[model samples]
Target: MSLHLRKPSFVLISGLLLSLAFTAISLISYYVANQSLNQHITTNTLPLTSDTIYSEVQRDLLQPVLVSSLMAQDTFVHDWIEEGEQNPEQMQRYLKAIQQRYDAFTAFFVSEYTHKYYHSTGILKQVSDTLPADRWYFHSRKAPEEFNINLDLDTANTSITTLFVNHKVTDEQGKLLGIIGVGLASTTIKELIETYQSRYGRQVYFIDAQGKVTMQGSQFSGASDIHEVKGLQNIAPEILSSPEGSYTYTNDNQTYLIKTRFIPELSWYLIVQHTEQSEARITTTLWINLTISLAVIIIVLLLQHFTLGGYQRRLEYMANTDPLTGASSRHAFEMLFQQILNFAKRQKHPVSTILVDIDHFKTFNDNYGHLLGDTILTNVAKVLTQNLRQADTLCRWGGDEFFIVLPNCHQSNALLIAEKMRQEIEESLQVINDQQLHVTASFGVAEYSNDETTVSLFNRTDLALYRAKSKNRNQVEVATESAFKTV
Candidate 1:
């Protein structure tokens, strides 16, 4: 096939081809060099930046949740409700005790089941919103143990940084008591993520437990609504899902480095993003290199009439093998299987086919997210390649599945290997975004018989796989004799 064709003299055409070849080589080299440099810098800096921001946010967010959880379980609150009477003096004493434990707790406040803000620790006080005769907190006083009674801050006040933890104080039979709540400054959380972003010259945002973007910084502030940014959804649904992973994306004609981690204690997500605006400026210089390459090609074409070279026939054989997995493609596998069949006819040795399907790969994509899915696929491919013998072949069939040709192996041997693969993949945990994803694979094994043809062997293997999947996935099963007999 002609690499290029533009009408020109023989000498010019030959020189042009040579110039084009050199230019291609030069372009490839430059791309490799640039990527390596970028990767080196990113590798050195990204983890430190991600960790710093994550640590800062984690402490701030967890502090509130922990304190709230602790207070909700406090013995004093339970005792007070069981006493069956509201004593203003006793309530003030309990509030003072809690305030001493947490310095951030500037005041201890109470709102009754009727929503009256009547009691305070008297350490620090504030103006209050109107109370309802029967408020949401009244229901919390009777809530089940599993239910978290943190007040939805938006329901109480939009202007203040506040979190309220309410618990049921019941008698032996579960009676309601007055509701207690504490409000704190929201500026504390704002300062937490913002402080780290400022320190590292990075950008950070905090999404609430419900997946809403609650806090964002100046660098990320351009997002009219952070939820509208496609990149955030591209990662896991929760930052805690993948505690640490860094990927690049292009947005609004700009490239960004995104790192995500989850805060389990607070059920919040921390996201750090960096724009590679400076990198884009460096990349623009690549166009200049292309122009210089074109000019050099013109000169070479003038001198040699652009003579060119070509590939050897052996290169076709090389092309058939997968460089990443070192396995044969469908075409090459078929050819090799035919060759094996011929050899077996002369001196018989049984051959088997194993079809392996990775289980819940969609969940991997959904849970840990897609980039990690690719990583899992690669790791699984490597594992399959490692398990096969030199004489056998393993090929990625498509989409979280693989095909293996076990030459000269009995059904027993093939079944044994399949079971091993199933077990290993099941117990394996791949770390992505600081979370561990447990993955598994299922297998169907079919052996070739003297009566079976090449196509029939594959058909039986496929049928066996259908049976395996139907029987509640994640195990290996061999094709029954009846399965191949009809085929």
Candidate 2:
């Protein structure tokens, strides 16, 4: 009886297997390619691009700063200011020569003794502390840095936005004479940023340390503050904290690769942002290919009826388990958690989760190599599995992280279980490179609340985990009941 259907079943099963294989191949190929592209951008392309932009900015903007510094140090300018700035014609001629020689947009000097402003056009205005327009000179006097960049109105150019490199002028006695600086129209900096953005196809902008957008390419002209920019405000804290580096920022469900370099000459941060939309396009293309492959496979399978009991079981196991640690994958964990959540909702039983993170996992990888990291991860998974109930679900939640779902458990019980697991992991040792390596982990436990979505519950647990890591690692933290009550 079985032999009669064997041939037909074999043909159908083969077709189904081939379909799954092709779909998996397409997905894996897309994943690898996307990862390679992102890695290339993060490691090679972004740094090179940022360095190139930094060099270009220095080449263009450094001249004004140098000119301002030179003018500040000039003996003639110092003597003129010391002479009470009485010779207006001489001052005007001197300013004109400096501005024309350097091809600067404008040149200016403020006398500390006379409290007067002298420009290329001569005695443009008085240095009044009470006037907002004249406040730049007062502020420049109090500034600690010898050379500073500021955005101010260019009176010579009808008060258009200008980049001023203000340099402090002091006499031989080290007394402050006044401020000497050269101005360049802000449009010049904007054009430079626009040119770079167009050439590199990256969003370019200049941000001061306070996160104020001083000058930006036309693409980002809508917002003058980094905190107001969409997809950027979310990661503004990280950006302002880091002096120079690369970071990945996620907003509106899209991720952006942000590279930042500091421009000391301008006292501003140069930011180059590129989106991962290319990866999304690649995934979309692969899905289209997979859909075609699936259609072909379905047609072939329908023509031949299929069955592969053992092979199907193997495939199911592979799909559900993490290849490296033999623990449940994120997908499998989500499915199981959903089932547990449904049952708990009906039975009025509680479901809890513990998010675990290995402490200093990156250090382990750096010191012992990635091979040892993999070994340690596998061993840690084993330790977690041995400590959990058979009904509990243990999942590999990406690198150096694991999630354990406990059904029919309350917050207190979940915390106890997490603490036990944390201790077990701390005690567990791995012999790598002939050295005994003891590992520790941080745990965050949270019980699901009534009417709470899975995402909200997970976020609460993640917050607890973050707190645990922040306070101290190798410990367990429980989410506050009030925190989930609102969720």
Candidate 3:
């Protein structure tokens, strides 16, 4: 009776409604599956990844801290500090030994008696209570912790970024002597993070309790503050307060899963974040069945990916290379310097550095305007490139100061090279607006010492450069070991 009463239009309308219901069910099922997969990843996979990171940090970063503590308790360090720290050469040699034995970036010591900061390079600076730069030493003196990890400029490697493991040095009576520790380059930490991120496809970063990013993987750049990261500000407060946990955050209509773990050793938070946007994309694709439209979307995505990849490569190149001189940038040169130093240490070969400063550069800039100054810089760089060996590295350190590194070269050879470079620069001419510009530069050369660090070598070389400038401009001076010993 019911079938007879139903009209054709009613039956058609009922069939449409049933189809719609099935479609809705399928969509809902897809959504559920996606959510389940993401939850599984956050709960199971992220914890494992976080554990791996923790283990690596323990092995690499914490080991240094432990070693530093052991050094603090060692009789040799205590005896050395107690002996008045009179022989800086001995102190320098001991610091160098510590650095070499542990394969640390650098080693340092501070003497409460002399109020002088000592490192592999000899006396770095005099610590004063009033100076802001010396405050770290004073603060460490009062801190209760046995050791602490912090970021500071690595003066040895041209003030490049470094992570310092500062440990308090004390005497047998438990009185504070000074401080001693090692440095790890920030580049190394970044590389470690980048490797893990690439292997596991997770965003990994280390942030301090104050929400400042101390270390991070290569995926993030430019900014290090946690609040600055996209989609992180909303959940940052909770993540900081909790020692270990997971949370979800949504930004720009996309969801992200975050896992946090506190590292007591570093007093920093280890954060791992995973985005669900990929899963969302998959869900969207499931609902769209237009073959041509799908193909078009894929093509556009491919184009965008390639374009972004190329752009990233270009940016990296620009960052590493000097824009005006086409020489290595300071940061890039520091990385290369470290590699060369390592190689030299292993091979027992000598490495030499030369610092070149353009003479009367300020006067020239004042007379000729910045455009001509830039032209002169470019011309000088060309002359330097022509004179240097292909294996050598030339860097525009800063403001009319150029640095060159020569591997497997001694002081005598480096001095000769510097002399030639000086002469070439003096003769090199830049013509602008029908006028010839003449430039002269001063050169300072220093060879790497077996027990000296890059910073010490740089300081010695800089002193030689100063001597050259003081005696007369456009001259080459080789740093004498006596100069370093005196410092």
Candidate 4:
């Protein structure tokens, strides 16, 4: 053969052999991996997800129990029961407060002696053992445990399913006096399941020891009995007998892994489900494989980044920003103060601080009402912010008081800035809630001393502000007036 023909033939043979070898090797590895992954998912992955869901559900359900326990031991409840339940309005108001504060679906107390059921709204009914609706109260009364959590419709109010936590109350001598507790709506539990499902891409439901489906999210059928479910019926008996275990079954020609855990607090089994592992698709070409893998990796990273980043940003904003005055929060200001101080020390620059307190603010708040009081605070902050340099940090140091940090500025310059801010606030005519008003503030300016800490600097400035208020209401004073410096 000629040289060109020989070369072409040799390349064709090499390519065929390479492709065949790769295909054979891939088949063996793929089969092995499928077995291992299925084992791993059944043993580790699905169970871990079940455990996480259990922990989150337990935390939420246990809170109502804790609150019910507190209500049971409350002195007011003890006193009210002993005094023959004289004030129904007071008890109603107390229950209302509990419901509103905790955002519970229902809050109630049933008197053992009188057999009366008092709801947050008013008296719902009188407890009687003969009535089917009041059997829960009786069950709670006879139960050995202090409390029991039940999922059922709240008959007194809307028939929407509610998780009721009924606790027994006792007197000083441990005699039964009443049953007290709160109810949580099913929406909360449903939302919890949906949240986890979105993250883990799994199905979740709850079942009792008797194989009865007690709780389930919107995605699952509201079937009352596990024995009714097509494939689940086969293993239902085995699962109902155990506290925790795993099982697999075929439904619609597809196998699913089920991980079950018993929650003693709610006396319910949490079941998390995952579909059986399938073989991964095989693709030829290293370039194409790399491209697909990179695309998938990017998507997963972006989702994680956004979820975590959004949460972190929200937390930081809430912690560091003042809601009312649009200034940095006290905590945020403290952190910035340390950073500014260190920068000043390194640059050999001056850092001055100013404190502004609205004169007669309490009396004004009392006279004009808190709504107008908040308006004045916000207005004062706006005026001060307008007068400040870009380097300055303003903080709502508390009610009617504002603190400012001026970096790379001397006390004299800070004094000028403070006086300007004070005068502008006094001059600006505010038309608040159809009422005309004028406001004045006392200003205290202090120069940072290297020997001093933040507290020392603040104390000196506060003393100066006190002097300004005592001497003349709408004026500025410097820390130099007190001659106070850190030793």
Candidate 5:
């Protein structure tokens, strides 16, 4: 059942009466509201913004690392390296495909044994133990980690600096074969970081495991290393060790609140810095509040309707949304589904539901870990959402499963749509937590029948889904409209 809220007229009337009472304790209410706003900024706004920036960074920047991982795992690269790397043109073509497909700045491979560097354009150069410029190749080969991100100037491909993700290639026996990876233009990344600052009104930058500031906007004056930054220097060691947390520090006599998240894929720390001093500079707002305190009746009477309605809308949204995937909540879905069913019955239009389940999701979750699983789930939801029509409704039915309602669509058309969605997912690779993954989904389609309850219809759909899974997964199965079974 949906909530029925009283009209904002009631709130306005109540607020007008309260405004008169507020004229008596206006000073006290001003202080309380000021404190509440400050707390809200720090507690809710900053952390929420931090999480958003973290996700965007993962989506935008971590892709190259994932691409490099795929390149490392490709059999063609393995076979070519194993065969003595004689075909330079073939390797160049392969590298070119990787670069163009991903839109990376450059793609390259370095052979440790032959000390030869192959770029998308062909052979770039040969590395040597003595050359300082080629130290990155030797360091990548000697490092215990499977991959390394080196930010350096690219003299071979572009004259500008680039961030290269170098991943180690190995044979079936796990013996080191070579190194392969892609480069991203530093300028492009810097521009992206700058946009984050303007968009979120926070200073966003990245620091390596050792505290060196590896990435930041061009307009930002963040120090080269966290240790050199005024306030962070004191807590640099603790910040480096902690996986994720919010820390407060004083920098240049200004108090700053910073949230740190350890991005394991890139081995970098995402630092989102917010200045509390700006909010604390509430002198102007405090004056306005005190001034409004004198005329509290006018202010509350003026804005009460907008404030109450906005808050009610926000609360309703929070209640109706799935926190993890941003899809409709089951409660919200039920309400919407019933509305659609009623309308379809009246208009005599077809309505169909598709049940989508990620095949072998539990195994993927177990092997790759929950973080990767959540990332995959989020991406899958985005894909489904993008493909949905304006009238169609998609809901997070449960973990790793999505329920889609296509109004005015017959079972056959819905089945075709499901097949399209399946093909899109099947053809794409999802990279998460520094690992590349191929994801495919199974779908079950069902059309609404006369006087059928939601429970009975979905039960049949679930049965069809079970059949699809039983038939080796990643295929679509259909349920007859005439079938009626309680779940």
Candidate 6:
């Protein structure tokens, strides 16, 4: 049976149907676009905010503490305090001398017999005060002698507070002559965060490994509790257990980026957070606004695609590229190594790598100047590129070390490639203005093992390189079977 539908009012029906279809599409597109905008904000902005916060804390607070710790362990300070207690005034003057070395400290003190102490702030306080029962100084003088932190209570008031770090000062006979206390103002850290916030418009927090908030950014009006943010707690456990990590979350429709890094100096975790609203919102809005103003949006995108995109790409290349050597930088090489490892796993092939470091590089640089050394590196790079096949890659792993990745290569092939690279570099010596710059490299080769992870594989190669250097330079050494058997 053939059934045919009647189409008497075709024009009217068609118009009504088309109008409804267009309205539905318009509503759906708007809904989808808005949802995407929200997701984009959540995914992108929060992470950027987290990174900004983390970097700021690291650059400002953690770095200073590290520098201070280095200065604290200086030989000069140790030698100056070697004098006995009979010369108490001399000891006081010695304290003054040490204090004068660094401008970072405000109050400096040495505690000998708990009560008998010598204090000096030659730059700020003219006459040093030896006030007893100083709660702050006494607290700093306590045991667990590694690092003593105490709040200065005597010379320290609410407004002008001081944090003290006391490290034991020992005599030549290894006798404890007292502890050296370095007073750093709490306000200095406060001002640091303030300055960082002013520049980056981000909030910073100095949280310990246990997720306790040590310091909060003055710009932050949020709660002081470390556990205030659920996302932070979840990340804290994993990141504190490991090296560094980041987490993103959304709260009250606002995106937050939280990044945590362990600051080795003060044994603290530096947490940084930023509002990723600008990048996320702008990118999303521009995409949505594209439909509304298609012509203008297209023009803007094209302009960015050509100008800003190209500029950023070029900057990234410069940053991750060795200019003179024409090879990838250490960072870029690591990225490539990971990619190659992944490919090797997927293809079920062996991945072999080598690290070659130039021998006597410093001597060459000192004798012929850095300009000739750079030229030598360039020539070495050219030789490596010329001799090696396209399948293999060479990168500037460090100043004078190059990493070579040979995918799907066995141990025999790997050694051959490493030796050939060494030979090529040695033969590529050039004389720049009567200065003979000869280049020779020591290589460490390693073949991929089924049980080895990517990180461990690199470590093995590094160990081999160390062995090669130890056994005299300008040679190739494969990682010992016993060495990697355990790994």
Q: Arrange candidates by lDDT, highest first: which order?
A: 4, 2, 5, 3, 6, 1
What lDDT tens digits, residue by residue, belong to model 3 across residues 174-211? 88887888888778878878977876566888889999
What is the number of backbone collisions in each predicted candidate, taken in the order shown? 15, 2, 0, 0, 0, 6
Q: Which stretches of candidate 6 lie over 4 Å from their true place?
A: 1-301
Candidate 2 per-residue C-alpha lDDT over 188-252 given as tens digits, one digit per residue, 9 for 90 to 100:
87887887687566789888989998778667844678788676787788888887988887766
Query: Which regions of candidate 4 are displaced past 4 Å?
Result: 1-29, 32-38, 48-222, 227-244, 249-256, 261-269, 274-302, 367-371, 429-431, 435-437, 450-452, 485-487
Worst 10 residues of 5 by lDDT: 292-301
* Per-residue lDDT of candidate 5, residues 311-379 (tens digit): 567668867898679999888899899899899999999999999999889988778655567778888
Indicate the TM-score of model 1: 0.40
Scored by TM-score, the top model is 4
lDDT of each: 0.62, 0.80, 0.77, 0.80, 0.79, 0.62
Off by over 4 Å in 2: 1-32, 221-223, 229-231, 279-487
Model 2 pairs whose backbones collide: 12-306, 13-306
Per-residue lDDT of candidate 6, residues 1-487 (tens digit): 0111222234335445544553454344445554564454344433444544444434444333443454356454454444233445544565565556644454354545433555562222222235443544444445645555554442423366565566665556656655555556767767766765654445776767666777766556665555676555555567678666666766667867666667664567766675555555656644453344333223333543455445556667867888668888888778778888888888899989888888988888777655567777787778777767788888997778788888889878989878887877777564545666666888899998777787788778988999889988888999876767666
**For model 2, what is the alpha-carbon lDDT of residue 294?**
69
Worst 10 residues of 1 by lDDT: 304-313
Model 5: residue 359 alpha-carbon error in angstroms: 36
Candidate 1's C-alpha lDDT?
0.62
Better candidate by TM-score, 2 or 6? 2
Q: Which scores better on TM-score, 5 or 6? A: 5
Which of the two candidates, 1 or 5, achieves a greater TM-score against the reference?
A: 5
When 1 and 2 are scored with TM-score, the better candidate is 2
TM-scores for every candidate against the unseen true structure: 0.40, 0.49, 0.50, 0.58, 0.50, 0.39
- Tell me the TM-score of model 6: 0.39
